[model samples]
Target chain A: MVRRDEFVLNVELSAEPGEVIVLLGPNGAGKSTLLEVLAGVLRPDTGRISVAGVLLDDTARRLHVDKARRRVGFVVQDYLLFPHMNVVENVAFGLRARGMRREHAQSHAIAWLERMGLEGFERRKPRELSGGQAQRVALARSLIVDPRLLLLDEPLAALDAGSRPKVRAELRRHLESYPGCTIVVTHDPIEAMLLATRVVVLESGEIVQDGTPSELARHPRTEYVARLVGLNLLRGTASGTVVEVGPHAVVAVAREVSGAVYVAFPPHAVTISTDRPVGSARNVWPGRVTDVEAHGDLVRLTIDGTVPMLADVTPVAVADLGLGPGSDVWASVKASEVTVYPA
Target chain B: MTHRRPHDWRVPPVILVPALVGLGLLLLPMAGLLWRAPWARFPDLLISESVVTALRLSVMTATAATALSLLGGVPLAWILARSRLPGLTVVRGLVTVPLVLPPVIGGVALLMAFGRRGVVGSWLDQLFGVSIPFTTVAVVLAQTFVAMPFLVVAVEGALRTADHRYDDIAATLGASPWLIFRRVTLPAVAPGILAGAVLCWARALGEFGATITFAGSFPGTTRTLPLEAYVAIGAGDIDTAVVLSVLMIGISVTILIALRGRWMRAT
Candidate 1:
């Protein structure tokens, strides 16, 4: 477990064995710094880190464990392989360093290489391997040490398009088999969803959202999170106990607000109407059709109007409304659909 | 891009003249020596007993010098290149002194420091009944003093330019400093070290001033090829001197060829 709080990052996480927790965030979000702090490559300005229930680093108490004794496997953005050593020797390094004899170390390395699906690459140097192959060799070398924790920094980001899917699948299989707490750092939503049991979204060195992928997609507290969850987020003012998005759109919320605020709604909330409807929801707009995308079992429509709204209506509704490029559409939403929060 | 010249016209008079001049400056001496060869007496002059003994001593002492450089200079380069100790820059400068120091003056400096009445030399003599001056050991010492710096500087530069993340990787793999140095650092710089060793050996074989100043001219004990040539020149034996020079040049050229084939292919 690692926790850091300085500038903007204030994260507290305790990962159990066999759990893959991915730290996901955009660039400059301090995701790499968090991983570095956890891997003992960087020291936190103020934090406490414990691994296997042992207090590894407690900056408040001036306690810090050296990286060499951290027993954590780290894979950086670029696979930092020793070019001089062949695959077998590179894998055998950790064992030899821990006082294993050359023959025994080599045997263990061979076994791990075989596990990584690199059986016959023992004699090849790091320069001879492709990106994915090098990543696998790096994984084999790191795992052969049997570290207590595993840290991967954008492991699949360095791969090309043709190699990405295959390598990601291979890495997923390896992560499943690794019986240790693994923390993978990445900002790609698909990668986080595919590889992580739980996702921690960091922004400007702070954990803004931490939850299961489904949960975060449904409820996001920040615009960054909303964008990541693919929600059309908007901000507006409130008047007369009603949050007014604009002249044509206003929603009565549970809270009585008198000033500026933020309102977020999932794309599925809006209902496309050919004409304005008589309703208590008090939100209506004749919008210009801006964008259209096919979601699972639904067609997502983006319309520019008094308040630009993304509506996830069924394809049947799309066809019924005759919605296509350059057509007028009325989008209406109930007050309850808008999640109004103080800005 | 920097010069803004067309690729086809890149080697115009502005570049070609200087390039040819530089090549000529480097090759003109070897050309002159070959042109002035006394080809008729070369075999007889080269086959003399003194010539043979000097050649053997040159091989022996130069090899010993190279061995000494590898044993001591590699670690020195590592320390200078990697360590952050105080006075490090000063130490690095001192290591390269032999490269710029006049060879004769360097020999005199060696004599002043390790001579019979010199500080360390007197104690060594008194404590162990050992004297190092004007002997085969002295010849080796003189050669090493001048040649070891080349190896150290070359290796230190290589080490400084090496990828340091390999050290971090090794550390995470449970490798302590010594193991990393032996398994990673040493092997990574092996080619540079080898190149330096070859250059050091060649320099030692051709060393003239230091050998004569520190280790005086003596047959079978101190007379390496250069000292033998100097002695032959003094005795009006120009043919023998030329033969020794040619032999030394030949040995150094062979080493260059072998190393070029072995390691320089990477460049």
Candidate 2:
């Protein structure tokens, strides 16, 4: 899908019933564009999209379903609850449009509202509800139609920092109870980890990696994913268990690999010292500190050397080593902490 | 709400003088009309045969003209504001041409297009044995010619400013285009439509040049209040003219006040 020439979405993925697939990517990575295509709001330029074995779109066959006819529930980041409609009316909108009687549709809407934990907000307008309440109302509105596929675009992004965790947990519960193919688009790694059964990493309109949350955290293929997961990634050539990241820098991992490879280890795994360490670890590099930053209880140091690396040291250790910009130091990590994989 | 800000006392004379002058310019004429009105004979003058007939005819023709404008102008406004038809800019410009055209010129243009011996009028006369000029129907056509732009322009602006995302959401909820229009779009823009109808009615009721030029002033058949006032002045019956003018002003002000409280204030 070409979204206003903003970005091209070249996604080939699917979600099974009872499974939630999170599209994890930074802004403008076409995560929302892919969701729109699946929701039938945006048509794909050239591709086939089938949900539960029904072809929603097939460019070669010249078959496409309009947004209205597609049985997909879309909950956008803004919640987009009709401001003029009270909570009950907003939730009953789909049933009313489907030709249900007013009383019956409203009764069903009330039931959905109660399920969403919005029992007393039935008469409140959208503007009267809190952010979390509005989100629940939007979800109830979309789910009342019993859609075959559910699409959520940054469902928790609109909540404040203090309420995000609470709403995130609630949304995860709702997604778990929903018996439909689910697709969620988000840029927050914590949200993705908490909500997704499987995470698909999107970068520059392409799927860079797709795996379970733990699997992606342990092995990220792209710098974007690595940065999101707080890992230091280096691309180099590998022979056996050693990867040549620089002229004098090599990392030894547990796996034996050859040719192009990506090596990753979390910043917390690296230790910084004023002098070269005498240890059995397989990776060590002497470098000059380029930048220093405070990360909670730890101080992060960016070092320039044979291989640029980030090391997270405790504040006490940083004080002991007098680590600052332009200071010389050696950073070391054990061989077991580094993971090497084919590019 | 009435807590006034302290006066700066540095009011610019240039603005204050003209502002008061403009208010006086509008209010002085109404005051003069009221001063000269024959209050004692107002009841007798209002109940006269000619005055009653002209008032009745004016209300009927203007109402008809307003209904016609609503029927045609509303759909035109929707198309102009919502459709992706090519060369829409040109179509939109043409729709507003009536607003800028002088009513007499519009009357002449209408006559040229719908006259008995001219263009479509000739075909109409031949095919249906219908001649529209100098008839009550001609009065409605003339008023509509000069008044339709108000409705179309108002409704089009409303349509453009309304939140179209609601329409998209409604469609995704399984509403067809027609149902969306009737239930969602129409209710959202009702204030604009009501305001437009009020403007169209007032313009039609006060129409003189176009109605006189195209339909002529035949006593009960085509003569409306404004035309009757003109005739009264021509006959040197200044009292009758004053009575008719006062009645027209009174009716328009009452209706506009009622509408303002509900529709125009929605802006």
Candidate 3:
């Protein structure tokens, strides 16, 4: 638990030594606060934080380790490199601060920089390097200290779209070989999917979902997670193959399970037509187009009817159907297209 | 087609007239000093024993005052910029009071606080058989009392504008608070401290009213160049006074030139 003025955040998290956990959340979700607490920068009001079997914080015992002794490396979103120092000095700062000799620290920093593919860039300042290069230097700076846990807050958010993929892949490769637990905070689901061994979704200071990337993509528990993974989710009670979702019943082809369940399907799984669909689609309902938005090459329409849902259709199909707001339309979904999981 | 240069914007008379007047007001005095300087006696006056003693004393006392200010003012500035203690506004106001208070009044306040019969000074006199007034130490103290506000204000401004997240990052990198301050915070604000020290030294070099009141103008002791100039004027030695004034003006111009880059960036 951490309190900042009137806002209070309570979170319980743990990661194994060889795991890369991504804390995925929207803005104001308290993800960065959790990382700060874990890194021993902010003391919790009432909680215990232990890393590698060593107790770092225990409010009951009134034991709190200083941040300098916690062996936690934190890289912020903007990568606050010491602007006055050169690249080698910046990377060697941690070692020098820990009482190592200057020459030895510089040599170690050079080795780490070379490993990060930053050779011949030791004397260059941070401003002279590209965003990606600076990020790698920040990582090298943090990793040189051999921390027990590494915390990166939106590590790749500073990169341009052109370099994001290459930098992200390189970051993933580096993280794979690290021996400590790593926690990365990002709001981009694609980034979370690409970098996380397990993704923990945080919403409004609470953990809403925790699972593997594929598990979260296949089954999202809340509207935020569902929208993040680009899926339509609805809560309902399942009675064999038919599930009462909202005001309408949705028939799903899954193992027979009778209880509260969630029905999830992609927007592209939903088909919209000006006239009522009457073929092999197991479920069909008449709905009016409430909103239309362009989603890449497909046009996504929010239809409101018996079961309000989102439907994605190609631009060509939208022009043919003349889809617009307030246009009456019939939405249909095949039984096999919807996946059911216990809520 | 002819194009207007981007730098050739027309200045309105409303602003241009006062701007030129302000420039003239600042430059005309220096020009008058140059015009009235005793050129024939310049070398003789510059090498005089009394002039050398006063100049050496002035430079030494001003540097000592600047050093004292840095010793106390840097930590005070950090507290002012970073601490969230109660009544800090009152503390800041008190620290800056010297900037606006009359220097004579500052000397009187210093006397009340550190004179022979004053609060702390009385105890020191009784316990240690020491008196601070009418000594070179008193001159340095007076100068420091009047000039330290410049250093504090400059350093606090720099600390306020510096990104504090760097401190947090340093801490996470296994740096103790003291190490962070020495290795990170100090270097980051070095330019500000240098500018502040220069301003403090310049102000201390010209301090006269406070020194005359508290330290008294004792030759080879508390009589700095400014006091020497005042004594020369009172004795009707106008050439000596003009020479000393020109020497001080030259030093002031050097300081201004040294700080030109910072001033330009600020503007």
Best by DockQ: 3
Order by lDDT, highest first: 3, 2, 1
Model 2, which residues run further than 4 Å from truth? A278-280, A326-328, B1-9, B263-267
Where model 1 places Cα greater than 4 Å from the true spot, the runs are A1-13, A42-47, A58-64, A120-128, A233-262, A266-343, B1-11, B14-21, B117-119, B264-267
Q: What is the TM-score of chain A in candidate 1?
A: 0.78
Candidate 2 lDDT tens digits, A1-343? 5546666778788778998999999898988888878877678889999988889999999899988888888888988887667899999989998999999999999999999999989999898998999999988889999888988989988899999999988999998999997899999999999999999999889999999999888888888899888999999999999999878788888888899999999999998888889998878888999999998888888989987888899999988888899999988999889888888
lDDT tens digits, residue span B235-255, model 3:
999899999999999999889
Q: Rank the candidates by DockQ, best first.
A: 3, 1, 2
| Poorly placed runs, candidate 3 (over 4 Å) | A248-254, B1-5, B261-267
Estimate TM-scores for all models.
0.81, 0.91, 0.96
**Per-candidate clashes, comma-separated:** 1, 0, 0
lDDT of 1 at B2: 71
lDDT of each: 0.85, 0.89, 0.93
Candidate 2: deviation at residue B194, Å? 2.5
Task: Give interface RMSD for all predictions.
Answer: 1.3, 1.5, 0.9
